[model samples]
Every structure is written in structure tokens, then in C-alpha cells.
Target: MWDHCPLMLMRKNFVSFHVNLVFFQVEDAQGREATIQRLADSIAGPFVYSVMTLSAITFGFWYYFGSHIFPDVLLNDIAGSEGDPLLLSLKLAVDVLVVSCPCALGLATPTAILVGTSLGARQGLLIRGGDVLERLASVDHVMLDKTGTLTEGKPAVSAIMSLACEELEILQIAAAVEKTASHPIAHAIISKAESLNLSIPVTRGQLAEPGSGTMAEVNGLLVAVGKLKWVQERFQQKTDLSDLTTLEQSVMHKSLQDSQSSNHSTTVVFVGREGEGVIGAISISDKLREDAECTIRSLQHKGIETILLSGDREEAVATLAKTVGIKDKFVNASLTPQQKSAAISGLQALGHRVAMVGDGINDAPSLALADVGIALQVEGQETAASNAASIVLLGNRLSQVLDALDLARATMAKVHQNLSWAVAYNVVAIPIAAGVLLPNSDFAMTPSLSGIQELSGYGTQKVTSVDLVKLEMTDFDVILGMDWLYSAMPQSTAEIELSSFSSQMSLF
Candidate 1:
């Protein structure tokens, strides 16, 4: 609730922002079409109209024919006054109409949605609505974000290249100077220093320039940490830093090698002290999560195509893709946010239902544009991504993506089952109640049976018109417990083994 306060304020402002605009045409079309769509989508919609029509036909039939047929039955069984034929016919027709409960039809899907969402919440998956589940069941392709989604967002310090100075001294000065910056690389250095239990010294006159670097006076020395270009530019501006050019060249040479390694791409940060020249460079790289590879494989085995979409360099994206077992053709690299959105649109144009998983500001537009948008709710995730997403992955696990797909398909199946049963019940029983077989004495059904059929379809007895009253609150939870959906997923995903059953239940 607290997390959504900003969005609530935005909505409040947005409402007032658009108050002066005339949207008559759009609103009219939306009003008419939305109403029609809502009515169509309601589980009991068709059934209710069918029941009304059947009730009128039943009334007309008995009103014309009851006088002849019911008189014989009542005379044979009763000793008291026989009610007027018209009144008896009207009563039977009303009974038939009233007992055909649309409430059960309405309650069926909503109940499942409520239970499913609540169950998902417990499992750290925040499904926005049942409509998302409905759409997820049709998704044939999944576009994944490389950072944060597949790999742990946190990058750790890998190696330090020091010039003449011990690596420990370089780290201490860098950590101390970087303490004022909140960049990912800064955090990596600080985290590494803390892991080594090194004390970070207090700095004076600290200044940080966005996209440049951070500089401060530490232990009476002018210490700085940042990108190689920014650090070099800073060095050129300082007369005392003239002697640091050779050291800077050495650090750059080593950092280039560390970055060019085929294993994975790494970010490098340069460190310098005014009087001592260049200190060293620190290498930081994000590591893949434990379940990332397995999750990608699991999704692929289900015949759901997996695509890696990232703004990272092609080499880096390719390395992560290879590590995760994603096909080369599906890997998209160095894409701007708009390009990512365009890719999603392209796939959709090809008649593929797409699900995009991302966790950053750049991914927000594509996330919103995808058929089903899934955002990994990691610590410090951008607000835009979360707001655009239809489903929020609170646990930040790729494996949970599989769980969501399985649950969505299962929930949709339940909806179909419920709706089919309701339609079949009305189709078969309505004719019987209308006395369709009354002329054939051999198989003619009695009035008691008419009432019985209606009530039985409702799965209840003692049903009154009140029981058939439109269910004011048809929404019900379709609880999909972790164990239930988990059991339904491939055993390879559950057991972490290769098996022939992996493709049995594809979400597509």
C-alpha cells in the first residue's frame, strides 16, 4: 500500500489534467463497446438470456396445453380443489425460470480468479487481475531482460589492477572516495571492501559529477574514483597529476584485457590520488542467478520461445544468452528502449502472443506494450517498470515465471469447464421443462422432474426465486496453491532432470 502512494497521487493529478479535454467520440465508443464486452465476458451472460427466453416459451406452452394435460394428473392424485389451469401453468413456468440459477455460472470464474490471485500473493507473485491470467495462457514467446531478471543485479568486485601500490591501498582509497556515490560500480567496491572488513576513512570536500566520477580529500590526499575518460580529464586539469599519465595507461591496458575476456563482460572503475599518481583499476561483473539457466531451459522445453533483450553490448548479451541456453536468433543486443518496444510489436504483428519480463526504467515502455508484462520486483527497481507491468514478480526468481504460466493455463481451463457445464445444463434441461416430450407419453417427464432438473443443475435444493437472484458478488478466489501448479509443471522443472514429459503442458 505504501509503495503505491506515488501512483495514486499521479492518477489524481492525471484525472484533473485531462478534465478539460473533450473525449466524446472515444468515450462513446468505449462506453458502448466496453459495456458489450463486459456483458459478453460475464460467465452467466449468455445463460441468463437463454433462461429468460426459455421461461417465456415454457409459460406459453403450458398456458395453451396445461388445461388438458395437468387436469388429468391432478384429478387422479388429489381429493381437494384443483387450482386454475392458468395459475398452475404460470407457477410451473415461474419455477422453471427461477430455479435455473445463473449465480453458479457467475460465481464459477470469479471464485477461481480470487483464489488464484490470493494464492499467487502468498507465493510472492502479485497478479494484477484475472484478465492477466487469461492473456498469459496464450503467450507463445517470452522476452527476458538480461540484468536483474536473469543475473543478480548486484555486481561484485572481481580483480584490482594496481600500479606500484598494493591492491589493498588502492581499494581503501577507492572505497573511501566512492562512499559518497550511489552508482552500481561504487556499491560494488564498497561491498568488496566491507567483505574484507576494511575500515573506510572519512573524506572532506567530496564532490560527485553525474556520468563523470567522485572526488574527495581523504587523509590529506586528493583521492578520486570514476570512469577512465572522466578520471583522465580530471588528471589533465590538475598540474600535480601530470606524472599520473604512465600509471593511467598501465591501468587502462589491464582493464581492457579484463573487459575483453570471453567469459563475461565486466565494468571497470579507475582510482587516482593527486600526489601519488594513478592507484589502480577495479573490475566488477554481475553473476548469473542459480536458477536462471534451468528456468530458461525449462521454458524452451515447453515450446515457448525465449528471447534475451538487453541494452548491453552484443558480446556481453551473447555471453549471457549462451550461459542461459537461449537460441542465438532470439538474442537482441544494444537496443534502445524504443527498439525493444518495436521488437515486441514486430513479434505481435507476426501473430505471436508475447510476455516481456524486465526490471528497469528503459524496459517500462516494452513491458507496457507486451501482451503480458511481467516485472521483477527487485530491491531499488525503477517505479516505471513496476507501474507498467501486469504481473509483479516479488520473489525476483525466474523459476516463478514458469509457475505463473502453469497457474494461468490451469485457471483458464477451470473457467472453460465451468462455462461449458452451465451452457450444457441449460440447453438440455430447458427443453424438458418446456414439455418438449409431453406428446410422447412413453418418455414424458412430470412437473416434479422439471423442478428437480432445474434445482439439480443449480446443485442445490429448496431453491427459491431469491436463490436465483443475480449474484451481486460473483467474484470468488481460484486458489492455485504452489504445490498444485508445481505438481502440474514438468517433472524436469520440478526434479531438475531431462525428461520426455517436458513438452506436455506448453503455455502456448
Candidate 2:
């Protein structure tokens, strides 16, 4: 009754082809009817029909030979009748083909990655994919290089000293001479002048030398502002040093001492009647971020280890770290870029997952070398590092790092939940597929048994022999991804929670 079964196979293949076409059509029908209709029309065309007919014919031939001709041939061979040995080999080959398909492993891994990446996007952290997220979550320690990372990149005048003049007068003269300069020290002087509401007198023929203070005519006075050395040198060249007072000597001595201690290449000024006597000096240094202490403490509470890596002096780095509550485990005092990368690699080699957060070109190599790299957006030097980083913080606030860490932890948790559900499904479905509990009279597992058996045998059975039937009853509900998580919750609320928790700890 089953002989000449090409029509039956054709009917089965026709149904399968339509079922797949319908499944794709439904998925593609994302509020776009015209596009979906075009896709559906393509699936119903001659090319699809031809492929289905060919597949049906191939399946029919394999079934016919397996149930009839091959078995008869094997039996005749055992009974010593003349039968084809090649026919038995072909039948065995067909039987093996019927039991193994390659779709299972091919479909599973990519699907898992897709789901993981989609979930990560919902958390406001866009990782390239699951592989990147997995790598980010595993970071055990973070090396935050100083300079632009821990402090404002710009330097401003923090302190100023004067003797024979008001502080505002000293700032005004300094700002007038330093106005045309682009150096950080110059900016600091100008900023001080602005804050004090000091009017900078416009200077004519302003000249600035590397080690010499800037010289300008402010209100027709030869105004000079820089190191005492430059001022004294210019002064002695044209003045009578024998007439200098004790108080002038003391002020100049203190200015010299400050210059040496600061290690700042100083520029001194000689303000006189057509350049005869020296007047004053101004010093500048880089400013630390106002929220540095708060940011450091927040990082500690999240269980993220922090280390400062910098090219600044050991004393300076230590002082800042101590002020910010960061520990003494930091690297300080003029580290080369190669040394930074080596340090990161060393930590990684010891089985510590290191994240290097930086905002400088000097950090690019180390950022690339670390397990996870984070770059802040506001720093211009961060461009190269940002490109290399697995994550880029859009704002200058270190609190954003805390935000990302929270989101990453949340994303990872969701990944675990998804993995657990997927594993559980397989564990429960596999046994029922193998008929482990079907014989028990207490529970009738038979109705579910057929579906489970078919699912389990998906790759084990011939792709053509397995009925391509849709089992809507067995489909699991859609699991939430990271996008859904973000839309459902308030990010501001999360930030507030983090802030409150941080205050309670005071670890920073």
C-alpha cells in the first residue's frame, strides 16, 4: 500500500514548505504588510515548489529502499541467495543518514548569543555582542590612570601670594601679561583675574620666553610675571642691586623656593620704569575633580577594586589618593605607557580580570590590553582609548562607571536566568523524549511523549522523515531581554539607590 509513494511525499513536503513560509511571514509582519506580502509571494513561487518536489522525491526513494528492497536484499544474502552486497552497504548508509542531522548545534549557539546581546542593549549598555558582555562581567580589578581620569584636565591658579600690592592687583598684572599665552599656568592666572573681577590692562608688544616671565606694558608699567630667577636676571642686567631692601630679598627668596618645589618651569616678570626692577610672580597647578572623593567611594561599595596609575610625582599621586580614599597599591611617579600595559598584563596573568579606565592617548595600549577598557567621553585624548574600549562612559562623572557596573551586573543576572531556563527545558524534555516516565500508570506522559520524542529526535532522525508540525502548546513564553528591563524601570531611581547605598558605606 505504501509503494509508489511520490504523491504522499510531495504532499508532506508541500505542507512543510508552506509552514516555514508562514512562520517567516509572521515574524516579518512587524507592522509592515507590504514587505511581508512580498516575502510570502516569493515563498509560494515556482523555485520553492521545485525544491519541495525534489526533496519529496528524494525522501520517498530513501523510505522505499529502507522498508522493502534493502531488507529483502539483506535477508537473501544471509540465506545464501545471490543478492547485491553493495545494496546492503547503501541501505546502511541511508539508515545512518536518517538518524543524524546537523541543525541542532548549528542553531543553538548563535541563538544564545543573539538573545544575550539583545538583552544587554535594553540595559543602556551597548556591547558588540554576548562575547564582549561576558568578557566585561569577568573583570576583577580596575586600574584607573590619573591625570585626565581622576582630575580635571585643565589647571588653574589655586593659590597666590603678594607683599607690596593687593592680591587682586597682582592677579591683574599677571593676567595682562599671560593673556596671549595658551599654557595651563597662563590659563590659571587669567581664571584668577576673572574670579577677582580684576581688569587686565591691555599690553603692547607682549613677549613670552620659555624660562623667562611674560613681559607686557600694562597701564604703561613694564609688567612682568614669571619665576624670580628670570625677573632677577632681567633686573640685574639693568638695575643697581646694591639698593635692594631686606623685604624685597625675602619675597624673592620665597618665590624662588616655591618655583623649585613646584618643579614648574617658571616664567618671571620684571615690571619697572622702562624695565629696571622686578615686582611679582604667580604659580599654577592642575586642579582635582570636585567629586573625586565621592566617585572613589562609590566604586568601592560596588566591590570594584580601584588602583591609581599616573605619570605624576609619587608624593603628589599619594597625596591625591589619600585625599580621595584610594589605597597605597597604586603606581605613581612618571610611569611609561609600556609599564602601564605590563602592569595590566601582570594582573591578568595572576587570574585577575583587569579593567583599565583612562582618557588619554597614553592609555590606549593598556586599554587595549586589559580585560575590559572604559573611556570617558569628555576627554579629547580618550578618542583612541574609546575606540579600543569595550565600554565608553558618555559623561565625565565617575558615577557613570557605577551606573554601568550596576547595569552590567543586572544584564549578567538576566543572562544567567535565561541560561537556567534553557537548560531546565532541555533537562525536563530529554527524559520524557526517551520514554523514561511513559510506562508509569500514575501520570499519563504519552500525549507530551510524542512531541518530546519528535523534538529529541530532531537531529537524530532524518530531516525529511521528521514531521514539520507546529506544536503551539509546547512553545515557551517570551523571556524578557535587557531592553524590556530598562523600559520597565526608572534609571534615575537606580542612581538614587546607588547614591543612598554609597552614603551609608562611606568607604570613599
Candidate 3:
């Protein structure tokens, strides 16, 4: 009950300045359609209207001056003015105003974005907004977090090596130390012990070093389980364990190397005790997601550069990159969460548009920093990485990254097409309304014809009605106008609800 207090709420939120900084940054950036529409509404709209209004005044003055100087030139049969300059000028001014249709210019970008985002929702992508789609279309580099983004985040313990203690003894003690951690590697150790019917001892003074390892007191003995160097540094500092020999260190290094060079790409975690020093190594293997390779290949085929960035060791990062066809120069290993964000920032500083893919909470920083952040959902394991991401794949499929990219490019293509149509419509209509051929042939676009032509742009669809709602849904919600329908809800249920609503309306 004490946990429900308001002061306790700040702990979960504002975990760091970076987290809040990323989440609040949505207001500063606008999507492709939004940018275009903003320019149209704020600047282009007024500018074009002013230009048309001034053109009418200028054309009226020119015709009025011509009526006195060369009356024959001002006489146009279209308006039936009988050489009356005021009537002709007023008629032509109205024609120009009607012909300057700004509807298409406003509607072009937004319509495409709405359809694209809605389609993405149907395909298991919960895109934040149309701006994300625009960013996805522009991504040149894709930075991938190895453990969860590329490989199956779930790892299983395959082998264990020991120097001073038995394998089972090291395993049990390691599990006790790891039970405090929520990491996939920790889960692997704890799960392995559970599978072997070994009960984990209740640990005291359990401590975690994020991205490095964990420590705890098991059976009144201090134990450290994490990276080899991390475990060695802590244990070797203790005077009681100072006598740990150089021969044992060399053997551990050899075993660590051997563990890395296995047929399967594996990560090695060291187990160290207070008195015995570096006692053993645990080799854990995480298989790649089934679609990881194909997705990377497709992105590469589309000329997108792919990079592997992770907190894992260089050997582990390299092995995963090689398996996925990412080049060696593109791989960076042993990065903390902050370093991952810094690497992405460096790439972006070099003018490369980088997209980050991650699945763990540690990935939130980089995911928030990238030009586009794509997060893959992990079943039974959810992280706030999605909260920082621009796109979330709820199906947990890596191939959906490519699906997002393709859809973005295609949607942008549609926007360009719509813009082209708007420009072509304006280009042809304006000159005709301005009465360019009135002197000789009396061929001019009348006010009625101009109104009809302008209506042609907006009559097809109420494009502005496409509400670009700020949707932050984990599951799909298809917003069709004012009605909200869950994509997961059955069709019959929706129909029944709609029928019930209609009956209520009839009774009213």
C-alpha cells in the first residue's frame, strides 16, 4: 500500500534524463506529410492566395488602363461586357480566385501517410505516426542489437568448465548470483540449474552492474558471475584470493577462446569465488531468429548499410555479423547502452540516416537516438525499448523491418504522385482563368468554369478527414473516422455492436 504513493511514481518514470528527453522530442519533429502540409497551410497557402489576389488587382488595373488607351483590346465576348472595363475586370478577378484551388496542395501528403500507417498497423507494425514512416523511408544505416534484435534473446547453457571446483558446484553458485539479474544470460544460468533439479540458494547482498555482470553472497561465500575480465578484476582485488596463480589465468583464457570458437556462436560468462578466484566458465548459445539472415540480405539488396552494435564481446558480435552477412567494418562490440547511442549519433553526424533495432531495456537510448528506431517484440519478455522506438513489430518477426521500409518508400511514392497531380492541375488552370487569349479569340475561363475546375480537386474525397491520430498502441487499433475498432476484435462482434448502436438510434 505504501508503494501506491505519488512520490514512488517518479522512480519508474524519469529513470534518466535521456529517457524523458527522447520521449518528449516528438513535438519538435514532423513527418513527411506533416512537413509538406505545414508549409502549405502556414506559408504556401497565404503566399499563393496573396499572389492570386494581387494578380487579380494587377490584371484589373491593366485592363482598365487598356480600356482607355486601346478599348478594342479590353473588349472580351466571354463576359458580355460591351467594352465595360469594370465588369470585365471584376468577372476575371472572380475567375482567377476560383481557379486558384489550394485543396490538392493541402491534401496530398497527409492522405498517403494515413493509408500507409493504417496498412502498417494491419501488418503487425505499430508505427507511431506518419513522421516515422518518412524516417523509415530515409534510413541508410540499420544498427542492430545482437542478443535480442538478431538472435533469439533466449539463451541456453550448453557447456560449463571449471578449474578449482566441480561443474555442478560452479553452476549452482553461479545461478544463485544470477538470480538477482533479469538479463537473458542470467536467465540461462538460472534456467539451467532449475532443469538439473538444483534449487538456488537464497542470496544476500545481491548487486547488479548493468551490461557487465552480477554479484551476490551465496552460502556466506562471495561470488561474481559476468564477463571474464569483470569477474577477475573483482575477485583478484581480494587479499584472500591474491594467491590465485598465473597458470589458472592462462587456462581460463584458453578455455574462453575455445568456448568462443565453437561451431555455434556462443557467449562465455565467468564464475569467480572470493577465495578460489576465477573458478569456471559457462558457455551459452543463442540461435539467430529464423528470418534474421533474409531480412539483412533484403536490406542490403536495397542498398541499405547494416551494422552490428552490442554489449557482447567482439568475438560474439563478429560471429553473429558473419552469420547474417554484415561486413566486418560495420560491426562494433563491447558497447554499453550509452556507447550504442553515441555510435548512432556519430553516424548521424556523418550525415548518414541511421535506424536502430533492439529488443531490450538497455537499448532504449540508442533506439531513441536513431533517425528511426525499430523494436522487435519478445514474447513473455516485454521492455520499454518500444516506448522509445518509432516502430514496434508485435509479431516479433525481423522480416517486418524490411516490410516497414518497403511500405515507407511505396507510400512516399504515392505522395509524390499526388503532389504531381496537384501541380499539373494548377499549372493548366491559372493561365486560362487569367484571360491570356481574351484580346484575339475571346477564349477565357469564366467564373463558373473555374469554380467547377477547383471543385474537381476536392470532390473526390474528404482527404483532410483522415485523422492522423497520435496512436501509441501495443496492439492494433484501426481508426476509421470517429469509430475505433480493435484489429483483434472479431468481425461478428463489431457488427453486433454496430447493430445494437443502430437500434438505440432508432428508439431515440
Predicted model with the maximum TM-score = 3
| Residues 1-508, model 3: lDDT tens digits | 5857565434443224432332333222224344555665565468476757756674666466645654665556653656667767776777777877677777777666656665565556667776777778888999899887788777878777777868898899999998867778888899999999998899999988777888999999899998767888877543234334443344345544655444345777878888877787787778778788999998999999999988887877897889889999999988888888889989989999999999877888888999999898753235788878888876677887887887777766666677777777777777667766666665777788887777766533223223222223223323222112232222322233335445644542
> 1 or 3: which has the higher TM-score?
3
Model 1 regions more than 4 Å off: 1-50, 65-84, 161-186, 193-282, 378-384, 441-508
TM-score of every candidate relative to the true structure: 0.63, 0.46, 0.77
TM-score of predicted structure 2:
0.46
lDDT tens readout by residue for model 2, 1-508:
7766564433455434533432342223222222222333343354334434443443454345433534443343321354444443343333223222223322223333333333223323334434454566666687887766777656555444554566567778878888988544577778878887887888888887642357778787676665444556554444445333433444445555654343222222333324445543344445566667787898777677888876544656777788788888764544667878888888888999888888766678888898778776552222676667766553455555555565445444544443344344444543332223323421212333434443454322222111111111111112212232234333332234335445644532
Local distance difference test scores for all models? 0.65, 0.51, 0.71
lDDT of 1 at 480: 24
lDDT of 3 at 437: 60
Which runs in model 3 stand beyond 4 Å of their true positions? 1-34, 66-77, 81-84, 237-264, 379-381, 459-508
